[model samples]
Target: MLPTEKDAGSASMSQVSTSTERANQADVAYGRLKQLILDGTLPAGAQMLEQEAATRLEMSRTPVREAMVRLRQEGMVEIRPRHGMRVLPISASDMAEIYAVLTALEGTAAELVAQRGITPRQLAQLRGAVADMQTALERSDLKAWAAADEQFHLHLVRLSGNSRLIQMVGQLWDQAHRARMLTLQLRPTPSNSVKEHADLVDAIAAGDGPRARKVHEDHRRRAGTMLVDLLDRLGLNQL
Candidate 1:
């Protein structure tokens, strides 16, 4: 079930307090809505009633609408004439495009990390993220695992220290996150993911850009292919 806007708003408020809190509120709304859609809480083709969302989030229609706009831009939601907003169906072609962009960005990060020599501190952070993911996986906590996975990649991008690359990758990361959640939910093989992540980390730590890039590319391609196959089996491909 999607969280009520009130619940989301209250949670946000508890975490952030300031005059500039509106921006934070909007971000929270956007992330929560996006996660709901990705996790199938707001299943594909489900109408996004603004009033209901506002009521649930404990926020006004304005912020909910703003969130919808962002989701629309991310290809996770669509607005129809007289029909209201609907969660967009995931498509294989869209998945392909997203993975393509992600591959490029990750490859660039790998090269940069090797060229610049990632700091030991940054590597420690990366290792710590992997440990968190492992713990999440061991406990069968899909959400925590997913969050940790994202943090790991985002940390790598930050290590690259390229503002433009980080910004572009951030967008791609958001799209990829939704797809990843879907994939993990369908398959739920925590052990495999842990091993793959560990191997990638090892390559990165060794400063082997080519190896690291190859491992990352292979992992993504395999995961994407698995997700497409799962969607096909579930008859979600028609979407």
Candidate 2:
């Protein structure tokens, strides 16, 4: 016998609920995978297996595929027909270009914030991130330190209140996440780096635009130089 109209409607509603639940699961999977990539758990040049990731994330293959597609769109993963997805390693070339772009973008953000001068609340946000980094360093929590470092820079950009700047810088930041982790691991972070953050904060607090720009520019370029030197030493001259 054919199903009644109410039964058909109930079946359709169930399908819709299942579809929505799967989409939510995919979002969760994507967020978790992205964090793993950023914090170095899924180190650069790693291979991502759909089955394995789905198992690890406790999600179905459909949601895992959804996550993988999003990552590919962001240039974080490459989908090979037979070989599966490979997490692209940040090459020397990638590092050089990323740093150059970030320096210019972040410098502009700093200048904007400084020119307008930050409110006390903004100052507190910046200081809070810097302080978290200092604490992470003292505790030898490299992962936490790296996270705080990103937050400090992002907070700086957000302070500018320019949505476009925030979006642009954020995308670049994500692309360079692996390189930044490698840099943090291979190089000895100078004590002055923390001091430098304080300097930038002070410049913004004082509404000194040029000083803010110069400080941020110098810091980013210095970091880029260090990472490139490391890559050269490791014979990875083209990334």
Candidate 3:
């Protein structure tokens, strides 16, 4: 007997549902694994097989494999043909290079945001992030401060309305996550960073493009230099 049109449609719908489910699972696996790496749960130089990672993530090996491939593309992991994945470490030199790119791209983003003139609500969000950083620092909560700091920078970049710039900077953020967290405590309190961020918000709010760009670029440069120096002085070649 020939299949009815309704039956064929059902089959097609089933295939679509299955594909969506797989993609969702793959996304879950990717987020979980990426978080593990970023938070130092799966620290640099760690190695695991696909089966082992799947077991840990409580997902199927297929989704885990897909996640590993994504991570490899982001330079967070290395996948050997039969050896599974090895977490990649960022060296001090790598951080320097990453910071250089971030400095240029993010400065441009700030300038664009200033030139475009954000809405009051957008300006409030940036100020709120800065406020969060200030409050966090007062309580000696570097972790919270770091999170807020990231929020401000990422939000500022997105305000540029440049999708490609946002994407490129996001990848860099992921790649630099471990080192930043590692050095978070090793360096002095980020009092200066909070102040600089507040200043940047003011500049953006005033629509001073050159001032916004200069302020952010100098902040990034100082941060990059301090982090590199600390890493080198402490002999932390890879993190």
Candidate 4:
């Protein structure tokens, strides 16, 4: 017997759902693997085996492989022929370039937030992130400070109310985490938020788009320049 039109449509929908689920799983795998690299759980030049990563992540190898492919595309890892993937070692130039891109994306976010004006709930979240940064700094916890710094920028970008920008910036930020580790090691106080974020937050609160954007952009550029200088002074810029 021939299936009804509704049955055929349902079958197609089922296929689509299955495909989406697989994609979601791949995303999860990608995030987990990236975090490992970013946190130096899998440091630069570290090799990651597909089967091993799958076991560690408690997921199937299929999604892990897919995640590896995506990470390679993002330059986070390099796929070796018949060998485990290697985490790419970033250089000073790489950090500068990354900060440049972040500046643009987050600069736009600042503009958007200024234009739209942040709500009270969002404002509270931003304030909390700032306070967290201050606390981490006082304790000399660079790691916690880094985490709080991430949260503050993340909050600003998220408060922009642009989902696309949020996703794009988030991915780039993940890759930059490796560079950030180096930065923190070289400089004990590695945070733009400690100084720059406050002014930008104030600009945002005042609904000043141009001021916020300018402040954010300047902060990013300064950070980029500092990273380059640090690497150059340490004779690592060429390496």
Candidate 3 lDDT tens digits, 1-239: 99999999999999999999999999999999999999999999999899998898888999999999999998999998878999999999999999999999999999999999999999999999999999999999999999998999889999999999999999999887789998898999887987899899899989999999999999999999999999999999999
Ranking by lDDT: 3, 2, 4, 1
Question: TM-score ranking from best to worst?
Answer: 3, 4, 2, 1
Better of 2 and 3 by lDDT: 3
How accurate locally, in lDDT, is each candidate? 0.77, 0.85, 0.94, 0.85
Q: What is the alpha-carbon lDDT of model 1 when measured against the actual structure? A: 0.77
Give the runs in model 1 whose Cα sits over 4 Å from its true position: 1-25, 81-84, 135-144, 188-192
CA error at residue 22 for candidate 3, angstroms: 0.5
Best by TM-score: 3
RMSD of each: 9.5, 3.4, 1.2, 2.7
TM-score of each: 0.74, 0.81, 0.96, 0.86
Q: What is the lDDT of candidate 2?
A: 0.85
The TM-score obtained by model 3 is: 0.96
- Tens digits of per-residue lDDT for model 1 on 67-127? 8888888677897755557987757667777777888788778767766787789888888
- How does residue 146 of candidate 4 score in lDDT? 82
Residue 93 of model 4 has an lDDT of 78
Number of residue pairs clashing in candidate 3, backbone atoms closer than 3 angstroms, sequence gap of 3 or more or interchain = 0
- Which residue pairs clash in candidate 4? none
lDDT of 4 by residue, 191-216 (tens): 55677888888899999999999999
lDDT score, residue 99, model 3? 96
